[model samples]
Target: MTSYTLGQKYISPTKPERGVFPLDHEGECKETMLKYMLCLSRNDNKPSLCQAESKDYFQCRMDRNLMKKHEWEDLGYSNEQQRKT
Candidate 1:
């Protein structure tokens, strides 16, 4: 049993704008995630160098229902096609 302060204000925590979702407990995208991480490590921690791996991981999450599905352009991969040209 604890006592409360006379003028203390209590603030309730709130969820983030995107809110929280279930984790990949079954490792549905573990390989893709590992590839992304490995790419980052090999590129001196530069994410720009791992765009493909990142996109693949995100796609895996969407396919496995771990996250909401979105377009590649909407996810900032609009230049992926151009880069391949």
Candidate 2:
């Protein structure tokens, strides 16, 4: 007796063509990913104040391994220090 379909729509058969901070690593963190995409093009776009330039472009793509080293609380982040004493 297992009926679970609250909104049945799930898709994740590992179709990950690389993109969590991947602008193809933007030629190795191009100026901190252009200041986190210019703080997401301003206009009061406060994405948590651009989480310290999005944790310095995901720690420069995990130091050139190109990804896979996550723990700013599993990327939900709280302190990677862009600015917020």
Candidate 3:
């Protein structure tokens, strides 16, 4: 389940193909939905950590890696690490 920080609250994912609109972000909802949809459209399957909130908003962020896979490998948290542990 999505988590929330003190300032930011959860705005559930929506049909992102519709495009990002100002109304959609009123009061600081999840703006990443739009970004995520756009990224998918670009064929960028690489996941990303995204967030949306006003100065008074708060929310937790997901883990996103660059298209490059070396970071996790260096940290020993690679997908293989999960399987091995």
Candidate 4:
């Protein structure tokens, strides 16, 4: 059995690197999220095959303030423009 000391110091947990954001209570990004989910399902859960839908969903989240805005490159969509060319 472990014993607790009366003078034990308390250490708070650190925040996540990405930081927490508000929930999408208005269903603002529901459609985009569903699209991504459907794409994943159709692609046999292969995320690489659903990159477009994944980006769309994240874009929607950023637009609705559900998450912080980040550069496409930071979000791993840097090659998106190249793929379109």
The per-candidate count of clashes, in order, stands at 0, 0, 4, 0
Would you give me the overall lDDT of model 2? 0.72
What is the C-alpha lDDT profile of model 3 across 1-85, one tens digit per residue?
Answer: 9776889868998764422223432323345555555555565554432111111121112122111223434433457544543
lDDT by residue (tens digit), candidate 1, 1-85: 9897989888898765552566899998999999999999999999888888898888899998988887777777777553762
Task: Please list all clashing residue pairs in model 1, or write none if there are none.
Answer: none
lDDT of candidate 4 over 1-85, digit per residue (tens): 9898889998998765674777789999989989999999999999888888888888898987789999888877767553762
The lDDT of model 4 is: 0.83
Greater-TM-score candidate between 1 and 3: 1
Those runs of model 1 whose alpha carbons end farther than 4 Å from true positions after fitting are 1-16, 79-85
TM-score of 2: 0.31
TM-score of each: 0.71, 0.31, 0.22, 0.71
Task: For candidate 4, give the lDDT of residue 29.
Answer: 90
Query: Please, what are the lDDT tens digits per residue for candidate 2 over residues 1-85?
Result: 9998899899777656535434563487778878888997883777677777778878887888777887766667655452362
- Between candidates 2 and 4, the one scoring higher on TM-score is 4
CA lDDT, every model vs. true structure: 0.83, 0.72, 0.36, 0.83
Query: Which of the two candidates, 3 or 4, achieves a greater lDDT against the reference?
Result: 4
How well does candidate 4 score on lDDT at residue 81?
54
